[model samples]
Target: MPPSDLDLLLRLRLVVARVGESDNANWWASDGVLSPTGQYAYDRIAPRTGPFARARVAFAVAQERCASQVPPGALTLWTLPADTEEAFDDRWSHWLDHVEDWAPTFAAVEAINTSSILTALVEHGLIDGQHADAARALTAAPPDPSVRLAETAHIDVDAVRQLAAGFACSQPAALVVPYVRSNA
Candidate 1:
């Protein structure tokens, strides 16, 4: 049988955890935007396992399932950017060239906040309120620079594991990736 949407999400969380471990940084720091190291790790693993594709499928399924409760676009607030630097550069240049034209698009994107998404997810019985609360706390901005720095150094792997497991089952099978540490 094909894996369920929850299963794909769990696998994706595992990939994120592994990438974060490799970079010595919190994957949630960028609010779903993978850092360079994280991107490298994802790219390295994607071809072998297709986690991203599976994640996209899962996301699509969720969006369809929650269409009435949540706006489809809201589910993709942190969609990954294209893989090529040149594509990014071109897109950036275009945006820079037509900043005024893109203002409304930017505004619309910004209006879809994390809280609403989490609320919808919780209401739909997709995630527990505790998970949503934990996510909100993790993403909250600390006032102190020292505290922020300290927080960044620690990646909450257990929280992610718990969230994933909660979504899937009481005891989900582990995803095994042959991660080889490199000194390069």
Candidate 2:
């Protein structure tokens, strides 16, 4: 039997998480400088070359193969556009040039946020109702102050809430409007 859409999504999540963990560990070890040893290590495992590359390519193939079976909005929640591959490569190159300044770009963060994926899966009856409620609750919460700081240290609480609202509004899938924090 073919793998279910849920299985594909779970595999994709695991793959993406592994990539993130590897990137984080490498960043900490090299301090984003990529010295000779670091360069060698990266060359062996970078997204374009070795295990990571193979895993990504396999996952992409699986995703494409299973696309027709996935429910509407499910694929969109988990998959990025084809052009994002080039953009991701560009971002990695930029990171190499700007050592010690590594951080997830806004688009990267948004794309990786799993709330929408979880919600969509639940709506499609792929995940349990309990998870659906949890996903909705998570998306409904106000943006973390630290997230705002990452984007701009000068943004106030109100501005953060406004931005979050705007972001939620822009998404094609249903996203709950974040409630205003009481202290704000």
Candidate 3:
């Protein structure tokens, strides 16, 4: 394929999973809602609260990073601290707007790297794949949290190597490139 075509094929995907604060302690009491047999009570997640439940609540709270791209690019999924529902919508919207502003265009992939986006996504709850190619594809399989970093990031390798000496990732090399941990 022509270089222009390859650049045109770039894809930008963002899948973020932010940890939110919880107030529904009794959510599992089965009193909120129950199944047909009443044996299993829904965990009452953001997805569970669809129109049938009540409303669309913000999910994956923390900081949305980028996921993947079609032609193997990068994405930016901005995640924010999801605490209360009072101003959730506003915060979510603002953060999303920010990400949108910083989002990379396929046309600019050559100028700006896409690895950082994928790393951010992985830091959040975007796609989690084993291979570098898969990671750049927005695969649904999210990788483990608290990884050293990605070589794609073009970060200091020795820093990650040092971190790996202490806190290493759980996933095998089959999933992704081994990241070394850093003391910092």
Alpha-carbon local distance difference test for all models: 0.31, 0.31, 0.24
RMSD of 2: 16.9
Please report the TM-score between candidate 2 and the true structure: 0.25
lDDT by residue (tens digit), candidate 2, 94-129:
435543332222123223323244433333334455
Candidate 3 C-alpha error for residue 110, in Å: 32
Please provide, for model 1 over 1-184, each residue's C-alpha lDDT reduced to its tens digit, 9 standing for 90 to 100: 1124323333333333322221222212233223333334554766433333333333343323323322222211112122322333344444445446534432232232222334334433445666655544432122211101111222233332333322211011221111111122
Q: By descending lDDT, how would the candidates be arranged?
A: 2, 1, 3
* Quality of model 2 by C-alpha lDDT: 0.31
* Top TM-score model: 2
After aligning candidate 2 to the native by TM-score, how far in Å is the CA of 107 from where it should be? 26
Q: List candidate 2 stretches off by more than 4 Å.
A: 1-48, 71-78, 82-85, 92-184
**Model 3 — which ten-residue stretch has the worst lDDT?**
12-21
